[model samples]
Target: MTKHLSTPLANSMGIQDQVSFHRTELAIILSLYGRMVAAGEWRDYGISALKNLAVFSVYRRTAEVPMYRIEKRPKLRLQQGQYSVVGMDGKVLRRGRDLKQVLRVLERKLIRAVD
Candidate 1:
């Protein structure tokens, strides 16, 4: 006798049901990541795609907690804007409808790192 397996809830919902970064969004994030890596201010990173939000986390070391979290929440798109950069302490450094604008907070740190 063969046993039937049930599908996972996520699989049944399909890919579109989850939030994720688009190519253009990744491009922008990567550009900043690359620069930060080269500056030696950031040593590692992680990405997470969840039901309501997507996140790109930057770390100073592989084992350490992420120094920052860049999040995109579609539900917040109509409210507090869709993009945000959160500090290690979980405080929002910046939030805006424009990803570029929201990411400037990190860029400012990069500039300081170089100095």
Candidate 2:
């Protein structure tokens, strides 16, 4: 029989040790989505929580690539800001400490003439 020095449970998240969204952050994101959805500008969305990042992707259609991505990287909380909105072109639309403000860049897309 072979003996291992470390236990199998050394690096893993248990069922209950999962990551979750902050209430304020969720409110900001969902509010934006709600407005976009009501305007028929967004059709679908997805969320991803990885080891070093949390991403919220917005889609114009179910089969196509996401139109936008809202990301949270805690590591950048001190450097270039933790929250960022990335466009479909993989460009950074905005980055800041406040989620609502960073998201304003996306809201700008919804603006149009009232004719």
Candidate 3:
């Protein structure tokens, strides 16, 4: 004879516990990434989908720390907007509700790099 146990952990196993970028959001980020890569300003990138937030980390090299991190926090969507771009030093360079607008900060660098 076997007994079945019901727990909160077990109940959540079937659900997706992590947050991630939507297709349209990824398109916006990747578009910026492609441009940066083409300009030789970025080399590698990483993505992390965590329980509360999703992060897109940009790297100049694989072994080094990420140069920038674009993050999406759904919890902040109502308060301070969900989209944010963080610098290498862990500073919030930009934050807004619109992903494309927030990403413009990085795009400015591309302009500088190209000039």
Best by TM-score: 3
Please give the CA lDDT of all the candidate structures: 0.92, 0.87, 0.93
lDDT of 1 by residue, 3-50 (tens): 756557756777356799999999999999999999899989999999
Candidate 3: residue 91 lDDT (0-100) = 96
Residue by residue across 31-68, what tens digits does model 3's lDDT show?
A: 99999999899999999999899999999999999999
Q: Answer with 1 or 3, whichever has the higher TM-score.
A: 3
Estimate, for each residue in 7-113, the C-alpha lDDT of model 2 and write its tens digit. Answer: 55844544333244587898889998999999999989999887778899999999999999999988898998999999999999999988888998988978999
- TM-score of candidate 3 versus the correct structure, residues matched by position: 0.85
- List runs of model 3 lying over 4 Å from the truth: 1-16, 113-115
Ranking by TM-score: 3, 1, 2
Off by over 4 Å in 2: 1-20
Q: Which ten contiguous residues of candidate 1 have the minimum total lDDT?
A: 6-15
Q: Can you tell me which runs of candidate 1 are displaced by over 4 Å?
A: 1-16, 113-115
